[model samples]
Target: MKELRSQAIVLRTMPLGEADKLVTMLTREAGKVKAVARGSRKTKSKFSALVEPLTLGSFLLHAGKTFYTFIQGELLKSYTGLQHDLERFVHAQYFCEICDRCLPEGEPAEAVFHLLLTALETLEVDPHPARVARCFELNLLEELGLKPALDACRICGKSGGPFRFDPLEGGLVCAECPRPASSFPVSAASLAVMKRLLAYGFQKLSVCLLSPQSQSEIHQVCLGLFQHIFDVRSLRSLQFLKAGKPS
Candidate 1:
């Protein structure tokens, strides 16, 4: 057995057998790793609390042929703030789902790892989970090399207002150009907000005031981009979030 130590955030966990659990985590150094926590299902298990989803910790793992085994872990931050609110919890889950989908196994994804960590931390105190989510979506797309052209027209490289977003072309199409059949009209205000969200870091979202109309527009645009780029039909966590919200 080979011993390895790293800073990790628990992504998810599944029960393996009667007393053990299969843990999936995103590490700062090693990217995504799947390890088994022996006896984690038992009441007396030391790994039980530390392996919960969204917990950040330092983990010592024993590498085996198939999967690593959780040896020792020191809890850092459990992000308990997220658990207090249903909306926050679901949003956090959506963030984790995106990461699991976008990141490749056993690859070093330092940018994504840091992005998720920062997003999680922001979610703990940020009153507007939607803003954090939007920021995360835009940044995640950029990190995965799927960033849509928001500044200039994809066809003519012209920068101006009142553009339409073409999902198939993966960019904003200028008003002068012939719009694609799938292109949806986007207002100058909405486009500007999208650009600002992409350009700025998550921390700035706290002070940013986005109009209700702009929020809806940005949500639709980001959702369309996710479907077009990642082929994600629907995210379960997002569904839970919508269902839980007051109408």
Candidate 2:
């Protein structure tokens, strides 16, 4: 019977009992929340468009024993631009999936909420999907306190390059340091890109021109660390993205 009001962005939604939907959302006030929207599947349902994934809105709910019941909501941004391109849509879904799986339920994550919001807004206007994704991933990792040390060697404190990334060790390992079997070499160009991506933030991402090699390397390093720390080996959105890639 407790009322909850917050600014939220829909993360996922699914049909429930025909007329209702089970919705998962990330809120600025309360990390992630799952609620039931009664009659949302109906043609004229108030929540029909309000509960769609990626819609940002002000929401009202009543807390139940197991889930919150959506009372009402006002739409803020639908991010409809994402739907115009298949690649953008898939990337957006991937971003949501990471937040959905990683964020603890009911915990306040204002920083994270803003990070996702900004990332989505950038994705809406930016043509560089790969850059946007990597930026989001790195920033999300940092916000979650799982940020990998990329500045210097993990052991020797060496600030020089020709390094490899060891996800288990959680940073870069210089050539002088002992190599772990899980470590993968990181090219200098890729290293610079990663450093700047972390340093300058997403706004400057437009200026960086990434080669295919740098792009692939950055992806591998971030994905490797992401999987190891989160224990999430597979992502459905990522699979869809790869499957859709033109040969």
**Winner by TM-score:** 2
Scored against the true structure, residue 91 in model 2 reaches a CA lDDT of 88
Tens-place lDDT digits, model 2, residues 143-242: 8887778889998999998899998887999999899999998888988888888887787988987887888777778788778867555889978866
Q: How many Å off is the CA of 159 in candidate 2?
A: 1.8
Writing each residue's lDDT as its tens digit, candidate 1 over 198-242 gives 888685787777777777667777777778757454778877866
Clashing pairs in 2: none
* Most lDDT-accurate candidate: 2
C-alpha lDDT of all candidate models, in order = 0.83, 0.87
Per-model TM-score versus the true fold: 0.92, 0.95
